[model samples]
Target: MITEKFRRQLRTEAKLWQTEGLIDDYLYQQLSERYQFDALEKTASSRFITILISLGGILLGLGIITFVSANWQQWSREVKALLLLTLFIGVNTSGFYFWRQQNTLSNTTNKKQKLGYGLLIFGALILGANIALMAQMFHIGGSPYGLYIVWGLGVLVMAYSLQLASLGVMAILLIGLGYLMGLSAVFYPGEFSWLQFIIEYMSLVAVLLFIPLAYWCNSRIIFFLATLIILLALEISLFRIFDFLNHGLWGAIALTLPPALLWGYDDIILPKVNSRIFQAFTRNLAIWYLSIGFFFLSFRAIWQDFILVNYSEISSEIHWLTLVEVLVFVGLTIWEWLCLARPNKRDAQSWRLDLVSGVILSFIVGTAILCFWHLSINEIPEIATFIINIEMFLLAAGLIRIGLARGIRGTFWGGLVLLTLQIVSRTFEYNTGLLLKSFVFILCGVGVIAAGLWYERHLSLEEVRK
Candidate 1:
């Protein structure tokens, strides 16, 4: 009830019990805590600024996507192509600009918030454009193989000028593969009429061109050459499948397959990945590919001899021997899956899904047998396939959402794996035309929803509103 001035004077007088303490632990500790908090408070402000800047970048990216999609369909094909080319150039330009800006890492020390923010904005815009271009191309009519060329050139430009050499080389190789596989389709109407060109003239030329460059400039060119060679071998195998190659030479083909698979290793995929983690991962995959390919080739060579007595039935799949082959294949798959999935799936690159895919593929080898054995797949089960794809797509989308939401790498890897499996599934599926296309849209919607929910959970309404 006393006056405020009187109370303050009373408190000060009462606390003056010891104005100067001799090495008091409590006072020293209190001083230290206050100093620590003062420093922490400064850090907190910087963090807040960073968060705001990141949110701004994300919003800008989404805005670009929304803008493009809103007006996309109204644009013509040539414009779309030009837009994609422009996007590619934009990305490369942004990367090089950032590299130049960030070189020597001194800008951050100099407190150049303006340069940093500018880089982020430009990079986010370029990324948005690239993604939009890819999305448009995904549904675009005619061949998409041409777009791959544009992407390759962009990567090349990014790598040399910006020093992202490994990624650049990797991208170039993928585009090179696209060109090799789809070139005939690009030039010819249908069928691989220029198969020999890929095998003889083209692939060798690529090896000659890329391998030496990798040696001198980047050493990652080995991966490019190796993968291209492996692709060449794969193309050869596909051609052999169509021509019904003689059973006698299957043994030789099986033995020689390992060499083609050697490129599946770090020597091939690592430089493209260009990280210790990725190199190890790719090496593991290479080993797996080699071991599995070896086993299948060896086992098939043995199986081929047993089926020679009724080769015609073997070709048509009425043979009892074909059933035995199926049993062996399934047994191997189950064993492989168990081994791969055991002890909590220690292997990051488990090929279990691919193995399952292979089993289904082998079953499809003889369509008559499949119709007699399992009819759900032989005659297009549109609704069921659609539902399954939906579930799979949801799961993939969920996992990616969770990963990206929490900034976890595992979730990204899982999402990418699921996408790969989906790609494989769709590749094998016979055309259901519009139904399949519609299913893809629904799956993409699920992914969009999941991503939105994750982002919304993390970002405040006010932050997003801007």
Candidate 2:
């Protein structure tokens, strides 16, 4: 009998031949026998070099910081920031110089080729730092708009120079954080304002601009970048709806919301986005309706009353969203159905486990709802909604278990999606008092940390397998 290990090796071999366009019955049999045998060594060498380059960049950066800080007694804050910035400039300049040198080095020996790769890696790191510093210097931290400008330069330049996904990842992450910070400021205002939030969106616009560039260059990093940016932009727009209308309702929309919907468009947007994966970020078709109508309906209410429950503040005759909300919901439901019709590769990968977990959790929720629905009859389906909301807390616990047992990326991401829903569900949620809210938060914290232990166990198992 072929052991699982041997079968896996055969599968790897088959994949290799297919990639090489030498796929045939005989080639298949040859791969099933044994691989080229040098694949592991070649892969290991590449990985080792990648690690060295990454680690060296980190250590060098830290060393520079240490050396400069040790002389802080002689250097001012401006001087320190400038010195750090200059160090980054030097590193990036070296990268620029080395890239030119590569043409000449291409004819060199294997050792020289390895050195070229290392230099390229080092150069990429330097370029990353340079863009980051430039962003910082340009007021990335002080102003919301500044963040976008800096990130724009960083992301665009990094994609062009190294085609590194991590650089793109960093850009997307910063964009997400910028959106989060902007939203938090909007709801909990001190110095942060709508202008700053708009600035955050400006960076999003920049992301849109560069995604095409990344794609034209044939970088897969662009696809993920587009994904992150699209999801993030939709999230920000949704949060704006909350601030403009009902914060709690916004949370509702955020929770039940599907990410693919945010990036869904087939006839025009779909073909356009799909044509260039990097530029394919889409907005849920219903979103166009939801955001515009939501803004108009809630704007006066938010500006005039500040408190939603004080119906006395507004004229009953001047209802803004009389039937719009119903239509929006209907449209959203249809959009979600469309997305479910043609689920992405991620959805297909673990649909069985997802369905199983979802069904079980649904059963659990249905029972819980039956138990609690009578008490919450004062609320409509919103009660079932609330129960469903809390079930996310429980669902995450189960996903942690699945992620551990199955070693599936789908389970891991699914769990995180559920967790995000749980948090989004609670934003500006009706709070009876500090005490109740405190208990609820305690439950959330404890539950997540408990689930994290399972994740840690999964990591341990992975280590053992390695």
lDDT of each: 0.45, 0.50
Please, what are the lDDT tens digits per residue for candidate 2 over residues 1-466?
3333455576777777777887987777675445333444555568788889879978997997788668866866577577766665665556545544542212333333445445545554555555555555555555553455455456556656666555555555565556555554433445544455344344346445545555546565555566455545555454445444543544345433433244233322333445534222333232233223222222223322342343222222211332243235337545644553444675554223245423443443353343233222333343444544544456565665667677765566566555654553464344467777667677767766766676778778898988
lDDT for 87 in candidate 2 is 63
Give the top-scoring candidate (lDDT). 2
Q: What is the lDDT of residue 92 in candidate 1?
A: 48
Best by TM-score: 2
Q: How does candidate 1 score on lDDT?
A: 0.45
Error of 1 at 16 (Å): 34
* Residue 215 lDDT in candidate 2: 55
How well is each residue in 134-166 modelled by candidate 1, as lDDT tens digits? 566666443445545445544444444434445
- Per-prediction tally of clashes: 0, 3
Q: Weakest 10 consecutive residues, lDDT, candidate 1? A: 367-376
